[model samples]
Target: MTLGNWFALLVALVVAAEVVRALRHRAVRQERWRRFFRLRTTSWGLGILTFLLAVALAAPLLAPFDPNRQLDIVHLTNRPPSSTFLLGTDPLSRDVWSRLVYGTRVSLGIGALGALVAVALGDGLPFAALVVAIGLTSWFGTSRLVRAEVLSLRQRDFVVAARALGAGSSRVIVRHVLPNAAAPIIVSAALGVGNVLLLEAALSFLGIGVPPPDASWGNMIADGMPSIYTAPWSTFFPGLAISLVVMSLNGVADGVRDALDPREAP
Candidate 1:
């Protein structure tokens, strides 16, 4: 009936789906995923990211009040943090905590979705037209990196042996070249998450993204500027959320890069 109830229902459904997926793939070892979080930095970043995502997902359950609901004018405006309102009220007398939680969903969702789609497509039309918007942008760098690696790899003794055994170009590339070249491409993708989030925030700030009624970090900051002197907390929390997410992503990326680098001794 309430917003929290709806969120609880959604969470239940998500859990159900995950259970079904796990059962369907029961043959697959879960260690593969666990290995990814083995590094201390990656574990910390993932822990933060997981917490944020949990907060966002359970926003309705956790927020003390609706993000957009204005409280009684006499008592709620620009109030400092207290038991009644943990993070204090915003300029509009809405719950700062609620808005921050919802805004997390908006900003992180857009950034992550955009980056993943763009990276997965590998410079396809949608990758350029919607996500990154370019002719040869991040794609160019990744392609060049892969090409150089492939070129060097193709000259290796293993590749020569494969070719000598009548392996087709496609077979050699797929079997030998790609497996070796995958590391850099993966590292680049991990780093790109931070870059994409920044771009999403910029777009939201400019009024072209994650429109009103739905809180996003960029829009919240934009909205708070006019009343910043009177209500600084309104802007501070969302900005902090953005900073944390980006920093966490970068930390995870760096950890993953180091862990995967061939030059690093085990």
Candidate 2:
């Protein structure tokens, strides 16, 4: 695998591990899971995200052709969807279906990386400067949300009890404050993935994203712009992918927020 593919695989593994760990937690299993699954939107969103993640993880095995391979510039370029090419060929004659499959890895990998950086550092960097820039621009809202949650939780009786028990600040913050503050952070991260994906696509469209020969939804859309009328599938498929992912993420975020809200009736 190429370095980018390796990095994407690593990120996917780390995310999967984290998810497994989270699922094994008592609170997540008993409370969060119960409430989260109560919402139909959450179920649908989770299903869609899971399918996309699976597609990304299985890209090498799933993609029919190399994303960067141009079959024939003269004859195959900008061809409409056919039995051979599922989505169609782009201006470069690369398989759109193949690129779309691979692009899932790029889009989700970068989105997950950016969200992690934003949560971990409040504002941070990534392997791609574009990812870093998206995280930096997006962290403030999450930071504010977390800061509010932390401040409110700090004044609670449990935090006071922990402080009285001589727990160190770091221990108290990690065990007491952050755990209670986790719901909003988790929701923010989920929502942030979609935002980061959109931002990355925008940057890529503007010629500063994933770079050529490597397929990204943004660059794919940009490449299709000139031939949009003749070959609308080129732009339509990628844009639809983006929209579906973002909408699914938003649904999940809203469900999570509702599920975690103390004010909500059980």
Candidate achieving the largest TM-score: 2
Error of 2 at 59 (Å): 1.3
lDDT of 1 by residue, 58-143 (tens): 77786767787888667778887766776777767887877887787766755665445424655344223435442224467667
Per-residue lDDT of model 2, residues 1-266, tens digit only: 24554565456556655653464453355765666666677666766787678778678865677999989999999988876887899988988988998888778877777335423553323235666677678889999998888889889998899889999999998887765676689889898888889988998888888767678888899988988999999999999999989988988887787666665535
Once fitted onto the true fold, the runs of candidate 2 whose alpha carbons sit more than 4 angstroms away are 1-31, 114-127, 155-176, 258-266
The per-candidate count of clashes, in order, stands at 0, 0
Q: List the residue pairs that clash in candidate 1.
A: none
Question: Cα lDDT for residue 205, model 1?
Answer: 77
